[model samples]
Target: MSGHVIAIDGGGTSCRAALADAEGRVLGRGKRGSANIFTTSDTIGENIAAAAREAVCDAGLEGLPLKSIPAFLGLAGINVGERQRELAKALPFADTKFVHDGVIALQGALGDEDGVIAILGTGSVYLSRAGGVSRSIGGWGFAIGDQASGAVIGRALLQQALLAHDGVREHTPLSRAVMKRFEGNPEAMVEFAQQTARPADYGAFAPLMFEHDEKGDVLARDILLDAVRDITMALDAIVFEGCERLCLLGGLAGEYRKRLSPRHSAILQEPRGDALSGAVQLALRAFPPQAVGENG
Candidate 1:
């Protein structure tokens, strides 16, 4: 169709695309590999294009020229203006808007309403909107920030494991298990860490902390509590920013909900939609009927 919209949600782990009509009816969907600007910038264009093409084909529009599609991409690591501009120029779509992944998440979660959202996944970011003013707290990526994120939790687990090995910290089943994963060899752990320093690599260990926490592992519980504290701090900041509504998004949201205080939890609301839906919303706004020369 002339006014088809292609919405993309791109992150460190995977990229998802959905084809939709002007009325916001979804037609088809597709998925592909990582599209994080910092991690996959070299191939992000190819990845986005591939996902869009697949989505179009899935919509039974295999012969459609992609340049006719208006797209919105909400991507991780695109907060850098230069990177956003560069990637926008490289994409194959006729018209496209590049926004921080958090923007789409906020749009999807709150629509036109005012609120705050904390995204806790392989990374974390806090975004809030009030009186048409948008403010962000974190999401500096895994290295310096992203507290309460899976990557942070996972990295903490590894650090505790090493500390336990050195007798600098109390040992626990969780640490022992982590050490066992490296065959009780600290050198092996070091080698692995050196080879796999990416946030996704560290985030792979996050589930192990949860698993051990359920078993009452002290270290694991401590790590989780630390993460919770970080998340709570961000929530407090959002509240101070005048946002009364909060929505938690991403893989770890549920885990965090249970750990949050009742006061904070009370503010949490279900998201109105997802990032892809928000992207479709953006596409519709950016390429309205008049812009597309479409008659009613």
Candidate 2:
């Protein structure tokens, strides 16, 4: 039997799915937890399946067999070919196309136009397309890259908190708040860091920094300024590479936008659509109705 198209935008923080008919009309949507291949590859299949199932149900097609669907997954941390193949095999859909999440973000943000996009959320990556050539910068994961990401900002806050506790750095409202969360015990902070060092755990502290920055906290300002510098560097590189239009995407995009210099912000353009829409676009490109054997 013929089936609907499924498009997924899977990231380190969450996975979103949408169902669309042959005519490219969206029927329903669903969401689930992290699907980052680097951190959650072992459970990626389950996460994708759960999100897809919910979207199908939301589309009023509950109990439909997932194997009948053709899905396109735009996922984080699937840049490596081996990882892509591994996750593709694990998915339940009869036909699946797996591409890095940046691809969908670019497609959604710029359509066929030449531009650059900086994705700053739980992790960070910069992508640019011009003259049919696409290039990616950073996105090396939270460990070595994602320099201006929430995870990095949050980790920096914790480090500053510890420095303040040690008298090596001046304590500000932001660092004090972090210390308070650990009950003023340095050991407690160490224990928490050792036990739960995931990107999301560190990313949880990002909002607090933003809040403190708005309140004029020196430490928070310092930390965020450093992040802004990193992001600005990436943006500069994109412009130097010949991209005239730029878009900032993800959770931290809005926050960073406010901090950017006018020169950098001047080129920012609103995205044409979100990542899910881009994934659906990719789904249509890869699994058009004719290719799926649909009868007109």
The most accurate candidate by TM-score is: 2
List the global CA lDDT of all models.
0.87, 0.89
Candidate whose lDDT is highest: 2
Ten contiguous residues minimizing lDDT sum, candidate 1: 287-296
Per residue, candidate 1 scores C-alpha lDDT tens digits across 130-198 of 987788888888878889888889888999999999999999999999999999999999988878578
List ranges where model 2 is wrong by over 4 Å.
1-3, 240-242, 291-295
**Global Cα lDDT for candidate 2:** 0.89
Residue range 53-135, candidate 2, lDDT tens digits: 99999999987788999999999888855878877788899799988899999999999889898999999999999897888
Model 2 residue pairs with clashes: none
Supply candidate 1's per-residue lDDT for 112: 84
TM-score of each: 0.94, 0.95
- Looking at candidate 1, what is the lDDT of residue 184? 98
